[model samples]
Target: MLRYGDYTLSDDLITKITAVARHDDLVPSFVICQLCHETALGQHPNSISAREDNNWSGMTWGYDDLDPKTRKSGVQVTPGRKRPAVEGGYYIHYATVEDFLKDYGYLLRNGGFYKTSGAKTLWDHARGLFRLGGAQYDYAGDGSNSEKVFNSYYTSMKTIHDALNADGSLDRIDKGESSNMAGLQSLFSIARQYLNEQMYGSGHRRIVDTYNGQNPLPVGYKLKIDDDWCAAFVTAMSILSGNYALTGGECGVERFVRDVFQKKGIWLGKVRPQAGDIIIFDWDANYWADHIGYVESVSGDTVYTIEGNSGSPSAVRRQSYTWNMWQIKGYDRPKWDYASPAPLSVGGKSIDAIAQEVLTGARSYRIKKNTSSLFE
Candidate 1:
């Protein structure tokens, strides 16, 4: 129960905020912060439009009034000015809060503010929203102008953001609950759900492959899918499971194994693998992964995995493995919390869990030589 001004934060508001954030792939904290700025968390007298007209984001009224969805004409009077008798004014009105938030999401998404500069942080998104409204202030600037008067509006919204984060009210949105995936359940539940769907075979491959295909290819990307689509299935499952940002969209097994897994340090030798870990395999022991799947369980020296493209129909199945199993190239584990029946250790000769390896390998090279040994 967040309290600000005269407004008590409701679950309905949170749900609408979450919906907009997920739909636009933006952070919900920033969206709500912007809403706080716009409506003053129901404090600003002008924000009465939210309750009276269901207009929450300062949207303007249209020319025609025939559409029932469009409510009363919006008006925003200055502190000293009286409300005009005309049917329209500066702000927009809506029939419902849902319509208002949905339109705000559309503005953020289709208006090119989110795409061009990117909204990676709460402040970045807030600044983007401010820019959308033609505000010239810096996103990270102190809340003071030349008059030395603090901008209470901006400072107040920022405080709201800080409070939400400090109290963990923003945790749900931060953890992808806006995307319907949150908590420890999210770390594995989505993948398990896809596995239960039992999507398998080349006939059903299109379902996952087409989903993975939505990602735009980088410039000069030439490799295309033509054969076994195990990687595609894995990548698609990750996207559908709401972990696409973590698993990535690589359709090639070798690319996913080397680029996504190894590059991110999630790649590990099949030592003490756990459930929710992605198992990549090479059919020929050539160090080139040709297939991938999710680890289901581990019993003694045997490891079980749910893999797509297993049998002749390319169906998904759980395969068991013994010690030193061939085709068991390595495992790629998501850095998330899950129910691991076996205890995970960090070091020693024991098969320590291997998901948190430090980032290594040089990003660039420079030429240097010893001056003292020039004669030698």
Candidate 2:
């Protein structure tokens, strides 16, 4: 049993997270874990700086400083400080914990931190961020697997959570419980209890592709198409995986990449591309940007993609594509905002119906409105 002063380790953070979570009615533990993982308890100088300036991660403009507010904070790197720096190298700041929690909650809700709603429980969200989502401290280019990285972060988080939970420290300090094992179970129970009222109140189910004989979409679904297949593939995959949003409208490939930078404030181009990052292309030879694909693997200069809506039949397909063949347009980062999954509605009908509407123009089957609600 771990303890932090009068309160248990898990309890203290849980109370802190809950104070903010109430506004969104989501789990605060996940956010707390992420902050701990990202800033190392605000001990890192970069985290302190970034937090003060509303830049959760230290993403600076190259040469030119954009955003007058951030510019005033001196957010840009000092130049020639090496490509990537360690711990305090990337920091974003906020004035108060309330502000920090608000931004943190926003990131968890709409910034692409998790799959669309219900699919990822709070625990999964916390674990995922600690795993491959947050800023990478080590840049040695060691070929360690993502699973290994996840386990390492998860272990550290568990230790912190345990310390917070030992004697109900969080509850006494901030009137909330821990968000680890015991607390997670409670959250799931609460979510299930309010299933009918929540947007993604229904539980998440595994999406199956019936066209491919009910097969799960390949980890990196790919296919070859004559024209630009990048955008189509992203839209197709989102629908196939039940991650599409009809209300905010389906975020196309280019929009998706831009959103990662704009909405989430993540600096994808500077970071090393990982397995799930989206890779863009200038397929049409136009500078305006044309296509995109999810990176499946990268060996030397050759990269593979799990593309959708490409090749004959125009269905979700997988095929080998060369990295060199396409001009590099930067990486499409995943932010994993699952807390407040966007409501999908078009023409006054449910998003599922709208998905069907869009799919008619697409080569794949679209989700149907009220088709097998999962949570309830």
Candidate 3:
């Protein structure tokens, strides 16, 4: 009998993939399975190019090319371009796995294919690949008639998932050694705080307070200063958690983003959005960004955000407001150099309790330190 973790390559790959998925608040097993099917566990490096260019299923290039009328000269042909090129057969290439992962995460985050009723979870994402009764699989290369490819991918993913017990259950081979419960909880809690700050005011601390109260500012509030809510939230969480800072700031949002981006193997400079990533936006139309938000969720054509000072009188608030409007001007997700556990106060009271007392419905308690500076 083959044990679930028998395949070393698949197991290790799945572990890495799961870490990525979990960090992105996605289902680790589902993403691993899908990628396994798509990349054959990196056996087909060309598949990364395929995904980049044609969005093909783990394969490079498409079967057909564009006609000459549609073709334009001066175009770059990178990689995975089929021979006897058609009019618009352009080659694409990904320089590294980091590049591929960023693009892949962007696709999954913004891909319309995953928004349909049939594709809510990572499991749905996998099954949706075999839509139309399995007669046709989306993204699968043409002339590849083997259903075994998908089966192998699915089986391999299941094997990995069973080994890791990635569903937050106890089926794992190592008894959940790989699960980062504390890390995940911290991330989630920080994300919630980020949302609250964006919609209401950073001054507001408690989630319950923001949920119950009216807008923090007056009805006709207009913000004078623009603070990068996303960056500020990240910094606040990092400081509270006692993480190391590579750069100086009031807290350390930029440093945190930089560290996390580097640590997670994600490219730091980019315009694409990833789920749970702190997205910075330049509201003043200047090249230098002045605003930021956490990607609460991504649905086709709609991105749910948790930002600070989005409302009038741009200030920190407790509740998070959802905004579908606004163009994505810029983004940054930095890697962390080191993550130290947040120190426990001698009193031993939970952070949540402190935040509640500071933030909850006690509008008087929530104080606005400085309007122009994110550090405040």
Q: What is the C-alpha lDDT of each candidate?
A: 0.52, 0.40, 0.40
Q: Cα lDDT for residue 92, model 2?
A: 36
Please give the RMSD to the true structure for each candidate, in Å. Answer: 19.6, 16.9, 11.3
lDDT, candidate 3, 1-376, per-residue tens? 1123322233334444444444343554456555544544454555544444433233233425543221122232335544344544444444445445544554444332332123444445554454422323443434264455545544655665555444543233112132233432444454454443434443533322222221233222322224234444444443333331321122223343444444544423343343544565545555545555555554554556666555665544333323323534434432221323344232565645543433444222111222211111
What tens digits encode model 2's per-residue C-alpha lDDT throughout 1-376? 2233332223333334554454443444545545555555444565545435544334333344323242332232232222245532323334444455555554344333432122134346544343244423221124267657666656666666566646654343222222222212222222222122211111111112211211232233432223333354454444443443311112245555554334543323422344444666665666545555555555655666655444554433345555446466666434322312323443465544544433333223434332211110
lDDT (Cα) of model 3: 0.40
Q: Name the candidate, 1 or 2, with the larger TM-score value.
A: 1
Ordered from best to worst TM-score, the candidate numbers read: 3, 1, 2
Model 3: lDDT of residue 291: 58
Best model per lDDT:
1
Badly placed stretches (over 4 Å) of model 2 are 1-40, 43-229, 245-261, 264-267, 309-326, 336-376
Clashes of 2: 45
